[model samples]
Target: MPASPHPDPFTGWLRDHAAPLTHLDPEAPLDDLEPLRDLIGDARVVAIGEHSHFIDEFIRLRRRLLRFLVERCGLTVLAFEYGFSEGFPLDAWAQGQGTDDDLEGHLGETVPVGVDDPLRWIRRHNAAATRPVRFAGIDIPAAGGSLLPALTPVADYLRDIDPETLPAIEQAMRIAASFAGTSAASAAPAWARLPAADQDALTAALTRLLIRFRAVEPLYVSRGDRRDYDLALRRLEGACQADYGFRAMAGLFAGNGLTADTSARDVYMAESVLWHLERSGPGSRIVLAAHNAHIQKAPIRPARTQVPGPDRIRLQSTFLHTPGLDAFDGILHTPAATVARDLEEGKTP
Candidate 1:
């Protein structure tokens, strides 16, 4: 008889499962899934992102985590920076209050890209769960400013406004300028892009445009309607790169405006953890999906202490180094040697 392929593959291997996973180098390298596996075993709140090999690892780990929660912890929530943050009304779908068809209509209006990414997979999984996942969001508004026309209506609002009022119209001109400056870069294809000079020109123009908006200090007053703002902020909260960028900018503007709804988004990451645990029983488990930046230690020292508590959340963040990206925690350093070899051997994809 052959052996069964079980969750933990280490049973028949060497005595210690830790040897393969740990890296001695000060900068942790992700060689395999051991560290992440260990983290999932004990953690009540686990956050991770969309790393290359990580997606498969997460699917496996989620299965384990879900089983553990249903059998032992009584979990009732799978908090996502994706659905709840974007106001997908996943809980409504889970409880038979609505159908995927109902939620599908709102997905385009809510999420930045169409919701065909990993987040949709998570939502579908949660929908099949025995207990419905509760809904919670950052409850903040979109940031002020005018974005370029190429962007959606929501983005136009975030690019050019000040702290007080929702300055939608005035921002249009600024967004136009920003886009005009980067028109060439926009035309370049990712596989075989244009010259670096064109890209640099666009980048510089964008920086200048955003900087000009900051200098002006415009006030964005809300019209007593938070529906769009809340929907936008919640969806923005779970995003990486552009989504996080927009969300943080919005949060800063809201803070400056002293808006009550805006204040809710400042602690959005923490609130997500607490909200999940609360929905579950006395000892519920949760798994969060977010980017490396959202999980990184806050610049303020005291804020780092908020990682492990009943209300605290834990994160497993990963990222690749690029020209414009630095100052991120939980980095998995890719040595120059490997990258050079990949490029030299024509294995660079």
Candidate 2:
């Protein structure tokens, strides 16, 4: 019954290097990586995601950080969480053309971005970096509820594991479930495995858990169906399977009208690391904007340390009480006007 030997490589390093690395704090005001300057030279990349209550805070923080990227870091692309059903012209979109309005209203009527927005801001800064930031939603299939059960493979795997690893794994699965519900229908089998009787039990348990997490805002739940719970777990796992790091913010569920105990923020930082490794170089540069929770440091052990499969990307992310709006080489929060419209239309609250 001795505590499990530290099963994670990064965890060991983090514990050993516990003295706050003078450079890790994202909010530091250095225009350059003066402390860990050599670690993230021109080739390295920095990705940040945010969940904020104020739209102005989101917009101002995001824009300032992004402006820094253009002036200091050779930032290349600006990606978004939502996409369009029909792919539109990136040039026109970037130029603030007719498509500037959000046709779907998922983000808002003014489109989550605008010509004067960060998208255009980055373009104005590095017009030559015009890679025509790809609109990937069109390529991704429309989401359906049928895929909820497809998450069982992961849940069953967690169910058979020990307690120490179970929470991290379960949390990861929840993050994956959230996204799986939005992706293709191939994820159904995994969801089918959760005991129908325990579904409510699990949801109720998670609802209590969420009560403590929603303070930072941006995380929410629309409904309390066991199926959505199943899907949320699967989405976390799916994102992890795809190499994205997952992190959950507590209490996000209750604020959005779902079980507070079970709400979380799904994240993928390792993917950003890998993506940065691939895209950054001496001359080329990239900047990413995402939730503050995604980049916060944690004491997480590797997924493979206790479970099977190659070491699933693991990181114990520190829960940030506030979003990292100004910490990036460049940053942009989702605009409030757009978020308001989505809430009004009942698309998302």
Candidate 3:
């Protein structure tokens, strides 16, 4: 037989460089993921990316990967692309402090796509594990289509810690309450319709609330528990981002310019992740679960750069650039192929 002229270029390249994925059994998922420890090395944060949220196979694969990271690699935190304000209940459920029903109820309108199975698994895992893994949500508190849920908590915290600041806190709460009637789709228009004075007052009130909290840090910390202090801070951060997001939306509608709203949300999510890392202290590893677009370390262009559309916003590029953080874009050819094969075989990957 005559020798073949050459191997196909793409197949030859893949054969030389690509690492093949191990088929994962649903009954024994982590058995196949042991090799990933070497691949992950000593990186503190392993960000697993997904191409889409609605895929059952992707969700199952992520759940298995999360189990591997937690059990084998000693990862202590599993952060999600969920609202920070709404994370407490979910965290409680994961830590075995709340019931599954409680978590589902608290998740309310902002549940992530294909989260049902994973949620049940996490609850069971936490209940059985000696040292339960913690959960952290890294998005702004817009899960309920409004920032009220986040802002209300801050106001209540202030009222408890420093009654003297209640007036200022209430002012901020009122501004946030104005958003209750607005849907996520109409937030920008509603914000744009507000009087300039109201807008300025809302901004000033939130700013002052943050400043006041900072100024009384010692008192707040001493009087309240650490969790309370942390919640207050998270609420403040969410409120500030809410304001920025509204402005960004307005800009998007008016064709003013590329607003920082999307960027700000990603930055806040990154900050939330870092905060969890800090709280967990040294020797802590985090398994961050977000969309591929939000986790990739490379510069990401807006989907439609040439056109004036919402897709043009480069959201998570800033977050990916955080120093000392290592990221892996898991939506690659090899693992995706593995997932496809598993789905075809009627097995969860």
Summed over model 1, clashes come to 19
User: Which residue pairs in model 3 clash with each other?
Assistant: none
Tens-digit per-residue lDDT, 1-349, candidate 3: 9767975554564465456556544446566566577878888999887655545566767778887888888887888877787777777776677555676576555534445555667778877787777888787775325677688777788777878878877887787677553235555567778898988898888888888787888889998888799878877888788787777777777788483446777788889998888887668888888876577664454232222222222232333222111233222332442224333555321
Sort by TM-score, top down from the best? 3, 1, 2
Model 2 score (lDDT):
0.36
List, residue by residue over 228-247, the lDDT tens digit for candidate 1: 54333333332212222333
lDDT of each: 0.38, 0.36, 0.68
lDDT of each residue in 1-349, candidate 2, tens digit only: 8777767555564455333322322245545333233433664345544554224445555565555554455555454332212123443455444443533332232223222355545434444554433221211111222212323443443343323335744654464354454322233333334455443344443443333223211222333334344333433333322221111111132244343221222222333234333433444444545444345443223332331222222122333332221232322223232333333555332
Alpha-carbon deviation at 289 in model 3, angstroms? 0.7
The number of clashing residue pairs in each candidate reads 19, 64, 0
- lDDT score at residue 23, model 1, on the 0-100 scale: 31
As for lDDT, the candidate ahead, 1 or 2, is: 1
Q: How should the candidates be ordered by lDDT, best one leading?
A: 3, 1, 2
* TM-score of every candidate: 0.38, 0.36, 0.77
